[model samples]
Target: MVSLLKNRVNIASGTPSRIKKLIDIEALVLSRLAVILLDIHPDVKGYSLFTLPQVRDEFWDLYKNYFHQRLLEGDLRICLYGPLPSGNEFKGKKST
Candidate 1:
């Protein structure tokens, strides 16, 4: 199977190399996001995020906080999203 990306550049429009790089990177990020979000209710447009037993909003707050902290800590950043009761609280941290 071959992607239309050809050898990294568009075979027709001839997309700029820099733009292609940006798109490739974004695609990688989004693919990871999709995998994480699969644990969600499967209806979120672009959200997964929950901490306290299906509490969608709370989950996102913790997720973002942890995400930034991980970034600051120079750790690989990825938010875990799920709908299980265990989502209620991880590490004693609850939604604000």
Candidate 2:
């Protein structure tokens, strides 16, 4: 479940606009997971099942923090395998 959530987050980060536009999908998945988790572990908190707004906001915060760190370190390109956004293009150099 953690892995699946992580994958979804990664994908959302890549194309935030697209994710935002199709937020129903994200909400559905999250809600379903939340229901299952809650059913199995009643003691657990429901914060993990944040609404679409929460997920979107939280994801951007995390993404910004990560991007800031890479930018400060002068890393030219950030290549996330999933939904995370690609980094700024560095002129006159190949990322590879």
lDDT of 1 at 24: 53
Best by lDDT: 1
**Candidate 1 lDDT, 1-96, residue by residue in tens:** 377445443221111233235445664332222212224443435323343244455345434643445555555344435555544345566535
Count of clashes, each model:
5, 4
TM-score of each model, in listed order: 0.25, 0.22
Kindly report which residue stretches of model 1 are placed more than 4 angstroms away from their true locations once superposed: 1-38, 41-54, 79-96
lDDT of 2 by residue, 16-83 (tens): 44434445455423222211111111113422212234444655654364344554556524343222
Model 2 residue-pair collision total: 4
